[model samples]
Target: MPKKVPIRKCVGCQERKEKRELIRIVRSPEGEFSVDPTGKKPGRGAYICPKLECLEKAIKNKGLERSFKTAVDDELKELLRQKVTSYEK
Candidate 1:
């Protein structure tokens, strides 16, 4: 039997991609945001590509804000940038 690969859409490009190929951002019930690498965090989640371009587009388009249903201000944006870069290493 063949196992099915999970698919998710990128909030930045709105493109469908394999789940393992993207990064996930989660908003805890307590309204805290974190970049989810293990993809096992319990919370509302939004997916984005790991590319910087996608991150920029997501920010400019307010994709994260829409996904999280909250204000994604400068501080959080900077945090996301740092976490993403660290993850890439």
Candidate 2:
């Protein structure tokens, strides 16, 4: 039998989903926050769906802040917006 894959929670919808189906946002040791396409970064992390709408929902509901336990700056929001746009393209 095939092993069941692990699922992760999306801060946006507060739902659990397959890890491979979501994008990972990571905080580096130096306190930098960025999207980790490779999902191999070493630091605190949060998962979200790759869809732009999911990102909007996450930001509007303060889900990212709740997951990271830190306020996300406007600059980071802009960066995330751009990243999600690129992902959608």
Candidate 3:
């Protein structure tokens, strides 16, 4: 029998996918928002695809804000845009 892979829900599409296939956005213990490539950061976390489209969907739908239970400022959205765009390339 093969071992089952873990799945996580994407905050963007709200769909379940393999955990390794998604990017993690974390809110640190200090209440800071940032992307965690390592996926080991402390505090609240949200998952999304590395694709720019997914990030756009999440941003437009306020998925991150709901996940973090806080407002997502424009600065964070800009940072996320740059990061996801770079990742897609």
lDDT of 3 by residue, 11-71 (tens): 8888899988898888888989998888888999999987888888998899999999999
In order of appearance, the predictions have TM-scores of 0.90, 0.89, 0.89
After superposition of all CA atoms, the RMSD between model 1 and the true structure is: 1.4
The 10-residue segment with the lowest total lDDT in model 3 = 79-88
- Backbone steric clashes in candidate 2, count: 0
- Candidate 1 per-residue lDDT, tens place, 1-89, comes to 88999999999999999999999999999988888889999999999888877888999999999999998878878987886676667
Q: What lDDT tens digits, residue by residue, belong to model 2 across residues 1-89?
A: 99999899988888899998888999888889998988899989999887788889999999999888888999988888888788787
Candidate lDDT (C-alpha), each? 0.89, 0.89, 0.89
Which residue pairs of candidate 1 clash?
none
Q: Over 4 Å off in model 3, which ranges?
A: none
Error of 1 at 33 (Å): 0.3
